[model samples]
Target: MAARTRAIVPDRSAGIKPLNYNFEVKPPAFITFEGLDGCGKTTQIERLAGYLRSRGEPVMVTREPGGTGIGERIREVVLGQQPAPAAELALMCASRAQSVEEIIRPGLAAGAWVLCDRFHDATEAYQGGGRGFDREAIAALHRVLCGDLQPNLTLILDLDPRLALARARRLPAASRFEAESEVFFARVAAVYREIAAREPWRCRLIPAEGTIDEVAGRVREAVDDVD
Candidate 1:
C-alpha cells in the first residue's frame, strides 16, 4: 500500500512566508473518522476530503453501513428501528463485509485515499459498550469480515455525550443509536476512549468541544503528525 502524504513548502518570495502543501507522496491509504452522533465527524470528513482533493489527491469518501448498494439497505434496517442486540451486530458485520469487499478495499487497492466515517470500532463501541455485548465476539466478527484490513489512521472526536446528544437532537431524523440514553452514549464514549488509548499508533483522540475551525485545525495537525 502506498502512503499518500502531504508535504509543506515555504514561499520565500512572499513578504510573509506562505505555506504550500503538496500531496504527491503516498501517506496512509485508509483513514477513518469516528465519534458520537453530532461530534462533527461528517463535517470534518468533508473538510478533510476537500483539502485533500484541492491538493490533487484521489480521495474516496464513504461511510459504514451505507457505502454500497446492499449496505445502504442494511443501514436502514440497522438505524431506522431497533433490533435485537445480536441481530444488530450481525447486520452491521454483514454490511461491513459487503463494504470491505465492494468499496473500501478496492479504493485502497487502486491507490485512492479512502476516508470512512465509521468502521469496526463503531461495533465495538455501540454493541460492546452501549448494548453490553461480548467484546471477544465482536472482535472475532471483525476479523472475519474485515480480514487484515484496518485504517491507517483513525481520528476520534472526543466530547461529552450530553452535549453531543443535544446537538444530535437538533438534526432531523435521528438514528436508533442517536436516540440511545445518556448512559448508553457515555458507555459508547468510554469504549472509544479505551480503544484510542489501547491503540495509540492508529488512533488519535482529539477534543471535540472547540469551535469547528479549532477542531478542524487539530484534525489537520493529527494528520500532519502521522508518521
Candidate 2:
C-alpha cells in the first residue's frame, strides 16, 4: 500500500513545533478507537490524526469493516443486510483480515502511525456482549484472523447508551446497529468498559460526554504518554 497523506492547515497558535526526526527510524504506533455508534470516535480520530500530522508524525487513518475495497463490500453487507450473529462475526473478521494485510501491516512497516476506527473490540462488544455470543470464541477468531496483531493503544470513548443511541438515530441514514435497542447498546458499552478495565496498560476508557474540544483535549493527554 502507498503512504496516505493529507494537506493539514497548520495550527500555528497551538505553539507545538513540528518534531525534527527521521520517521524511518521512529517506531510505528497502531492505535484503534472504539465506542458506541455515536460516541464521536470518527471525529476524535480525525482530530488526533491532524494533531499528530501537525507534529510531523506520519499518520494513516483507516476504519474497520471498510478500509480496503473488499472490506468495504463486506461492510455494506454486514451493516445493510444485518446478517445473523454467526455470519456477522465471520464478515467482520473477513474485513479485518483483509485490512490487516492490505492496509494496516503495510502502513506500520513503513513507520507511520496507523489509526483505525474500530477493531476486534467491536466484535467482542457487539457480538459477544450484545448478541450473546461466547467471548472465548470471539477471541479465538480474533487470534486466527488478525494473527496476534493488536493495537498499541486502544482509546474507547465511553458514553451513556441512551444519549449515544439518540445521537446515532439522528443521523440521515441509520445503520442496522443503530436500529438496535437501548438495552443492546447498554450491553455493548458494558463490554467496552470491561475491556478497558481488564487491560489498562493498552486500553483507555475516555469519557465521551463533553464538547469536541474538551474530549479532544482528554484524548491528547492520553496519547501524550504513548512512546
Candidate 3:
C-alpha cells in the first residue's frame, strides 16, 4: 500500500492554531512555476525573485533536473535524448530527490523563500499526461522522494501550444522534451490546466500570450495573492 502523504497547502496559516504556534513568524514559502517549454516561466521567475529581493525578502532560485551537481548530469541525459517513459520519470525523480535534500529543504528551514522554475507538476504533466504514466504511481514516488515538502504556490503560464512551440524553437538547441511533438505539448498543457483545476487555491493560471511587462503584471498579482 502507498503511504499516506501530506498535502501541500498554499497558505502558511491554513492548519495552524494560535495556541500551538511556536514561532514568532511562519517559515518561508516554496513557490514553483509550471508551464509549457516556451511559456515564459523563467522570465517570470526572475522578475518575481528580483521583486522579492528588492523588498527585503530573502529568496533562492533553482530549477529541477539541474539544481545540484549530480542533478545537472541527470538533466543532460533526460533532455539530451529521447528515453523510455520509465527512464525519463526515474531521472526526474532522482533529480528532485537530490534537490530537496541538498537545497530546497534547507532553504525553507532557514526562512528563505524558494522560487523553483519547475517542480513535480512537470512530471505529472509530461510523464503522466504525455507519456501515459499512472498518476497513482507518480504520486507514490513523489511521497517517498519528497516526503511532505511541496510548493506553497504554483503559478502556471498557460499558452497556445503552437505559439509556445514557435517561441521555443527560436532558442538554442532544443532539449528532448522541447523537441517533442506539438500534440504531446498539447497533452502537457491540458494536464497543467487539470492540475490547476484540482488545486485552485495553490495553483494559478496566467495567460502567456501577452508582452513581458503585461504578463509580469499578472504574475505579480498572483504572487501578491499568495503573499
lDDT of 3 by residue, 1-227 (tens): 11122344433232211111111112387888999999999999999899888888899999987889999999899988777889999999999999999999999889998999899889989898899998667867888888867687789999999999999988786676777899999999999998887666567999988899899899988777545
The predicted structure with the larger lDDT, 2 or 3, is 2
Query: How many residue pairs clash in each candidate at the backbone level?
Result: 6, 0, 0
Global local distance difference test of model 2:
0.84
Write the residue-wise lDDT of candidate 2 on 1-227 in tens digits.
12222233433342222222121212487889999999999999999999999988899988988999999999999989968889998999999999999999999999999999999889989988999988877877788777778787789999999999999999876798998999999999999988877665567899999999999999988787555
lDDT of 3 at 226: 48
The sequence of per-residue lDDT tens digits that candidate 1 reaches over residues 80-141 is 97788899989989998998999898887888888999998888888888989887678777
Against the unseen true structure, what C-alpha lDDT does each candidate score?
A: 0.81, 0.84, 0.81
RMSD for each of the candidates? 10.2, 10.4, 7.3
Global fold similarity of model 1 (TM-score)? 0.87
Clashing pairs in 3: none
Residue 11 C-alpha lDDT in model 2: 37
